[model samples]
Target chain A: MNVFVIGLGLIGGSMALDIKTSNKEANIVGFDANEAHMEEAVSIGFIDRKGTLEDAKEADVVIVSIPVNVSLEVIPKVLDIVKDDTLVFDVGSTKANICTALENHPKRRNFLAAHPIAGTEFSGPKAAIRGLYTGKTNIVCEVEKTAFKLQERGFKIFNDLGMRIRYMDPKAHDKHIAYVSHLSHISSFMLGKTVIEKEKNERDIFDMAGSGFESTVRLAKSSPAMWSPIFEQNKENVIETLEEYIANLQKFKELMQQDDYNAIYKEMADTNRIKEILKGISIKTS
Target chain B: MNVFVIGLGLIGGSMALDIKTSNKEANIVGFDANEAHMEEAVSIGFIDRKGTLEDAKEADVVIVSIPVNVSLEVIPKVLDIVKDDTLVFDVGSTKANICTALENHPKRRNFLAAHPIAGTEFSGPKAAIRGLYTGKTNIVCEVEKTAFKLQERGFKIFNDLGMRIRYMDPKAHDKHIAYVSHLSHISSFMLGKTVIEKEKNERDIFDMAGSGFESTVRLAKSSPAMWSPIFEQNKENVIETLEEYIANLQKFKELMQQDDYNAIYKEMADTNRIKEILKGISIKTS
Candidate 1:
């Protein structure tokens, strides 16, 4: 099986590693616009060989794992070249634009719009690790748009990689993910911005940071090249989440000014239910 | 050595566990406002025995680990009963209010204002774990106000627990903590509130949540009983931090509205420096 992975970074590199391990016969051909990343992925042994975009024509399966902005630019080109029987899937964060872009493509049946809800704060080929998608949720948007055989092939790979699949409409996936995923990255990045600005004068301010601060700001370390395009593609939904988040902070501040600690306590206690909600996500995936 | 832990929650209970392990001759006496917690701490083996407020006079060291609002209420009572040579230190999040309240106490020298920067989102006796303070920072405020002998004794305990100590003025500690610790909690709680509120209508919204959302919102699961008082005491600084945080979010949102992807990318790239900052904190503490 010739499995070609495009854009060799954290997601692409990790997927190649896992697929290589699960399918003994899988030949992992890797490509990235950044030649350094392609070489690093090869040296790291996640890539069996380096391939060009033109070589995607020989792939039995092609994994599109580039930034969403780049996905818009390169995916149509890949679709223009791949054979009819080739199964192609993308793991971008935003889905609506990509799904709509390929809607009228002649080889649309060969492409699958997927978002595997898995990542770390780090990026690049060096950040790749085994079992990156294990016990994680892989959301598939517009599953019906892909050919039946290709869908079956993708599911087999997802199962081999230990991912639980959830199907949803592309628009709904973008809106809901704006709340769950995109808003988290924005909030974390801005929190880091706020604290870093303050740290300018107070050199020891971070000395007092605890695990709480570290956990909340961890996502601020994510790749800007990857996230900026996501925020661009889901502009409306991301802005909406930010508005609601900022309003909540303002209201919390107002409660503090009013000396209504009981209200503040009630609000925190109410949000504590997120523990149960997150626990469900873990159990459902694991 | 008799170490009496009042308010047997995460901090106090974990301290008792580590102190017991590190100092073989030390006796751990636990007390809580709630009788069940006191009994549970005894059963968990972190607390060697149950005691009362009056029993503090027999203690060589007293650890005040209750909420900040409750600290202002109960700390004076503990100070009044402790022996002149006994060291009484607090592990509350807010330091200024408690230090101010005890500014002129007859036994002020016996009270040490300390905030151990160690904890998990979980609370109570059951959440107690060994080595919680190991390699974590412990902020000591107004150390000069503590008697030389008591300060020596407190430092000895901190050493035994393997904690790194940093000294700061109570006011400065509260102000810096507002940016690092308190503000992160508010951002996380608000983020959790925003997402959970949306989840009310979209029952499966959480299914789309990934590790990014989980990490950013983890602090929202903190005990309200523990946090409300910290906010109430650090209200002014917390509100200031919130204003800065909200302003940053609004600015980012405006950039999105203007389709200024380059500016957004710049902001994220700048905040990426926090990775280096946080790395320094981890290395300093560890």
Candidate 2:
């Protein structure tokens, strides 16, 4: 199979590499809106060659991984060009917008809307890592909308990369992701902003910071170009999640202000249940 | 030297183990108000023996590793009981309260107020791991107040553990820690709470969650027995820092609601400076 990957950043570049490992004969080509990333992906050996949108149309499998905003504009065009038997899918964070955009298109059945629940804060071709999808979850949205043969190819491709698939409606996928994934990035970004704005001594942060601070702010280093449009595309759900998050912070703050030690302890103790919920999300180490 | 460790949890227990590694002859005695913790410390070989508070009086070095609120109440009493030559110190998160408690004691010069900027969400004797402090930052507050000879022992102990020491005033240490460490915990705990409350499908969370969510909410599992007291002791600084953090979230949320993608993008791009600041807070891998 020839796998063509669009947007040669962390997701696309990594998937291209893993797909080749799964099937050595599979030729992987890449394209990115950024000229430098296209060159970097090829140089990094993540792809067999740099391909164009036209080249992507002829491929056996097409994986689109651009920012959510750009994905809305580009996925349908890819569908318009791809062969009928070819399977084209997206690895974007949000699903509703992409699903809606291609809902009534002539080649709608040729596209599978997927959100590969994997990635690091770092981005671009250089940030691509091997086995990133191993033991990670992949949510396939609106699977019933896709052709059966294309869906079968997706199942085999994702499984070869060691992923667990869960199916959901596009609207449900977007709503749940707002609370679980996208909001986490925003919270972390705001945390880094809050610390930088409040503390003048970068030296103090470096000196007094520990594992807790590092993990909490790690997501703040994510690519702004990739995330800003995600927030824009999932505007309503992201805003709703932020409102609850901010309200929870304010309530906890008031409890602190009143020196309500019991309440404060209860708040953290209750939230500790996250330990159980988190056990289900596993990262495989080689 | 005979070292007495009061409160044999993750901090004291790990420190005891590392001290033993540093010098095999170091006679480390353990004391915890909780009987099970003391028994576990002895069984795990983190300490040479499980001793009492009274037994702690004659040791050449005393390391206090209790919650900050208890540190305020117990540190002064420890200072009253210990011999003049004893080098007493603490590994609490907040420093101002601990420093103030021992400020008027005759053995004020015997105590070194220290906060080792290291640890995981887990606590207690079983959670103790060797070399937890190696390549970690150790912030010592009011170093000038410690007797010259005892301070020498501190320099050696921290150095043997492979920790880099940074000097700080107690007041400044508490204030700086609020923004860098305490705020991060609160933000994480509340993030976990908000998600659990809003998203009823724990299965969806397990499916869609990524590294971003895992890292952001990891600190939610931290012990309330430890953090509540730290928050209570450093109430003013924490409250002030939370105010700024909340305000920043409000501004970011408004930008999202307004669909001001450029402003949101700029907000994250500006905070990306954390990537550089974080490079300085390196974790030593053995």
Each model's TM-score for chain A is 0.98, 0.96
lDDT per residue (tens digit) for residues A204-234 in model 2: 5556777788899999999999999899888
DockQ of each: 0.87, 0.81
Best lDDT goes to which candidate? 1
lDDT of 2 by residue, B1-286 (tens): 8999999999999999999998999999999999999999989998989898886687999999988888888888888899888999899998888787777888899999999988989999999999898888789989999999999999999999998888888888888899889999999999999999975744555557777788999999999999999999999999988998989999999998787889999999999999987887753322
Candidate 2 reference-contact recovery: 0.88
A-chain TM-score, model 1: 0.98
Quality of candidate 2 docking, DockQ: 0.81
Model 1 Cα lDDT, one tens digit per residue, A60-120 = 8999999999999899999999999999999999999999999999999999999999989
lDDT for position A257 in model 1 = 98
Number of the predicted model whose DockQ against the real structure is largest: 1
Alpha-carbon lDDT of model 1: 0.92
